[model samples]
Target: MKGIHQSSMAVRSFVVMACVVIILAGIKTASPIVVPFVLSAFLAVICNPVITLMCRYKLPKWLAIILLMGFIVLMSLWLTSLVGSSINEFSKQMPVYRAQLVEQFAWILDKLQQFNIHISRQKVLEYFDPGMALSMTTNMLSGVGNVMANLFLIILTIVFMLLESNDLSKKAHLALDDPEMRLKQIDRFLQSVNQYMMIKTLVSIATAIIVGIGLSIIGVDYALLWAVIAFLFNYIPNIGSIIAAIPAVLLAFVQFGPAAAGVTAGLYLGTNMVMGNVIEPKFMGRGLGLSTLVVFLSLIFWGWLLGSVGMLLSVPLTMVVKIGLESSQSGMWLAILLADNVDDKLSDSSMENHKQDDTEQISEQEK
Candidate 1:
């Protein structure tokens, strides 16, 4: 009987792994279509609050959605213009930067050869082209354009999603045996996701503005462009801010030498330290329940699957998966494993103490 049970568990695990592999393959295969749809859904979640506010003021749903769409369009156009101008400016300066880079490499190679270090200039130059930064930026922005090409389709998707959001509770009632319990779980999930998105957005905006102003004051070229990059990259966890800082720091070095580059690095490090360490934790309050390892792994996995868009959405996507796992009796252990520094015994003890206090309070009130 024990052997049979063990075999059953092995088969179940295999089936689950197979399903996951198949799903990942399908996502990769259908990325062009899936990426846009997922992006639209993310936008819908972010904008749903605006729709709620408009509805609260007794506006028609259609009018509210139309206004929201208009706002989105305007924002998109402004961002497109900013990126366009930055790219133009960057292209104009690329030749100068490349020449400087070659000169710097030659100088470095000469200094190193004095110590009998025989690194080849050609080999170094092959790997570290100055235009590498510009090329990466161009590729990323072009991908953004491709994903956003069918604006009307994305907008339509958002419209239907927002309309359906209002009826989720009603549908939950019809679908679930324990409607109230299931609805509560769903509500908790949505609330957690919304809170995370809202707080992260505000923090990222603040970081971007500070970075932009600081870089501009320091005379960094393409300050606004770097700021926009910072804002987008902040959506990714852990190493994102560091990655965004590299190009600006490199530009500082190329344009104004090592001293200026040092200053630029300091500015980025300090700002990220303050915002990410001090402010974000106070507001987020252990709410995300994601470990550092999980966050980094998700970044790699999602980025591999969906490109930049995947990296940006990694944390939220992982959070959704974790929450779904928590809802299932058998899957709860997986969710617990993923949780950041969570101790099951400690958590159980805390719950017990809270229940005891609540019971005592009720008895006192009855007396």
Candidate 2:
């Protein structure tokens, strides 16, 4: 029996590994189409509440869906405009930024010279030169394809997702509706997803605002830009905050020198700490508790597979998977995939503390 159990465990492990390899291969091949579809699915989740509200109002579901789609389109366009404007502004100020960067680099080189430490500044210049030109930055922005086409694809997918929203839950119900159970599973899944995304979005936006204001007060040039990056990257756990802080701190160093840069770094780090440590856990609790190691691995895997946007969306995608897994009869396997490592530690601590309390109570009774 023991040998059979060990063999079964080994086979399970092999199957899991094979599945992971296949999924990664698929991501590489399918990212162009898959990225937009994933975005659409998440966006659909967010707007589902409004869709339900429209249905509740006795508006024909189709018309309500139309209105909701229009609203989403307008909002997407407005955000695009804001981002485009920021890009234009950043472009105009590139020369000044370049000069500041050179100045900062020179200061560093001077210190190194004083210490007799030599490093070629030209190599460093080549590495960072992309930030100097739009043409050069094409690699960063083009990603899978051009900006215009990517935007069109994303918007187009979103439209289809909105249009198909009505039939989505129907399909799920048709597939999963059991004689023993009613709509409870589906309802719980949707409710959990809606609640989790809402809380996540709120926390991210708040972190962005606080960090942005702090950066701006410290006289960081691209305060709004860094803030937007912070807001976007906040979706990624453990690593996003650190990545966002790098540019902000580098810019601060360029503009204000050491003292101001230190202050800027402090503010960014502190804000991230408060948000990640205190505020988020308070609101999120165990709702979407992805393991930190798993979250980072997903960020790296998806980011490589899809690009920067994939990294940004990784956590939400994983959360959706977790919710689906937990809600379905045959999805217990996926539940294990999404659970946090901290959960085990938390459980152990509670059990030990409970045991200690019980011992104390017994001692008191003896006394």
Candidate 3:
């Protein structure tokens, strides 16, 4: 009977894993539709606070949502225009930078030859491949088009989500056996996500503002453009800053030489160090933190699943998953494994307390 029970448990585990795999596969396959809705849901969460505040002032739900949605659309459109103009200006300037690039590469090759290393300018140019920038530009433009196309759908989703938010608790109460517990769990999860998003957004904005100021002072071309990119990519973890820095650094190098590039790098590094390493940890702590490996894996997985936008949303989406897992009995261990491990000390103390309680109970029963 014990063996049979073990076999049954094994089969259940297999079934659970299989279902997860199937669901993930479906999500990936349907990403064009799924990604937008998922993004809208997250946006709705971020915007819900504002909606609640407006409603508190006796604003109707419909008016509050309309105002919020209009604000979002206008901001998005303005940002899109800014990004578009930056790209256009960049394209116009690239040819002028090409000569500078060639000269810099030639000088580098000459220096390398001093160390008994030699490479042809043609080879270097081929490797650097100016044409690749144009390709990248095209791809970026295509991505923007996709975003514009989905703007309507995303807004619509947010509208519906906000409308449904009021009834969500009521629906949960009707659907669940333990409505109070479930509602509490959900409230906890939403609170965690909301706090994370709000903090992250503020940090990103502050970072971007600093970066923009630094870039403007440094006379970098498209300062606002790079700053905006930095803000967006800051949502991603680990390598996001590096990716965000690449184009700005490269442009700095081409336009102002290696010294300017170094300064730009320093600014990015310093800002990220202070904000990301210091300030962020004090607020986020272990409760919201994921393991470094988990963060990287989510970046890769979600980026693959939904492209660049997926990469941007990766950490938050993974956090939602982690929070969900942490709320479950059987999934708690897995969630702990993925966590940043800052909470382990607390868990250890709790375990010790449990053991002490068990010991006391045993002694009392024996007496």
Candidate 4:
């Protein structure tokens, strides 16, 4: 009987794994539709607190939503105007930057030859093409712009989501067998996500402002554009800041020289050190409880699945999966595996606590 039970459990696990693979494949195929809706849901989550605050103060929810949407629309228009022009100007100047970068590369190759290093300039350029980097930078901006082009649809979805927020709890209660327990779990998940999103957004904005100001002071052309890039990429974990800095540093090198590039790199290094390493952690506390390897792997996996937006949303998405797993009695082991520091003892303790709570509830019902 024990062997039969074990075999049945193995079959169940295999079935679950197969289902997960199928779901992931479906999501990948439907990413174009899925990405925007997911983005909208996150934005709505960010905006919900303000609407809640206004409603608490006796303001109508509709009025609060209108005010919030109006503010967002105005800010979006203002930023689009500035960033749009910067992107255009940068596009115009790309050829000039490309030429300068090529010359700089040739000069380095010649110096290498002077030191008895006979690296072929053509091979170096072929492998690490300046034009390729520049084009990639432009493509990154273009991808963001394309998303913005669908701003109307995204905003409309957000509005609908906000309007439906109050009804969600009601619907969940009606649908779930154990409404109270499930609602508590759902609330915990939402709260965790909301706090992370808010703190991360604030940090990203601060980072962007600092980068913009520093680059402008250093006389970098398209400082605003680079700032926007920094802001967007800051959402990506581990490698985002490094990727954001590359184009800016390269431009600094081409525009001025290695000295200016060094300064540019230093500015990024200092900002990330203070903000990412210091301030963010102070406020973020233990963070999303994800292991470092899990975070990095999620970045790559989600980026591959959903493209640029996926990379931006990877950590949050993983957190959702982790928290969901944690809420399940059978899935707590997987959650522990995904967690940064959690262990089997903690998982066992958690399960014991749940069992004790159930016993207490049963006694109350009997009484």
The predictions' CA RMSDs to the true structure, in order, are 4.5, 8.6, 4.6, 2.9
* Runs off by more than 4 Å, candidate 2: 1-27, 50-68, 88-92, 105-108, 119-170, 173-188, 320-334, 341-367
Q: Please tell me which predicted candidate would have the highest TM-score against the true structure.
A: 4
**What's the lDDT for all of these models?**
0.82, 0.70, 0.79, 0.83
User: What are the per-residue Cα lDDT tens digits for candidate 4 across 176-273?
Assistant: 44555544655656677788888889999999999999999999988987898888889999998998898788889888888999999999999998
- Give the lDDT of residue 272 in candidate 4: 90
Error of 3 at 302 (Å): 1.9
* Residue-wise C-alpha lDDT for candidate 2, range 1-367, written one tens digit per residue: 9999999999998997899799889987987677777766777777777777788989986787778777766865675566568777877876787777677688778888899988677755665542543343234334523333566566667667777776776676666654334445465566666777677678888988998788877877767767776776677677777766776676676677778879988887888788778986787676556777778888887778778667767777766666566556457556666677646735754675687699889999999
Q: Between the candidate structures 2 and 3, which one is better when assessed by lDDT? A: 3
lDDT of 2 at 54: 82
What TM-score does each of the candidates earn? 0.86, 0.71, 0.84, 0.88
Error of 4 at 245 (Å): 0.7
Task: Tell me the TM-score of model 2.
Answer: 0.71
- Candidate 1 lDDT tens digits, 1-367: 9999999999999999999999999999999999999898788888888799899999999999999999898888898889888888888888797677667667778899999998976676567664676577667667777887788899999999998987765664555444545335456667777778888888889999999999999998899989988887788889788878888888887777678889999999999999889998898887677888888999999989988888888998888788677656677778877778778524853675687699889999999
Candidate 3 vs candidate 4: the TM-score winner is 4
**Model 3 stretches with alpha carbons more than 4 Å out:** 56-58, 126-145, 167-177, 182-185, 285-289, 342-367
Q: Candidate 1, after superposition: displacement of residue 345 in Å? A: 8.4
Instruction: Give the range of the ten consecutive residues with the poorest summed lDDT in model 3.
Output: 129-138
Cα lDDT tens digits, model 3, 1-367, are 9999999999999999999999989988987888788788888888888899999999999999999999999989998889888788888877787777788787888889999998887786666644454445446345535756799999999999999887765664455454555335455556777778777888999999999999999998889988988898788788877767777877787778899989999999999999898978788665456778888999999888777767777888887787667555688677777777747735753675687699889999999
The collision pairs in model 4 are none
lDDT of 2: 0.70
lDDT of 1: 0.82
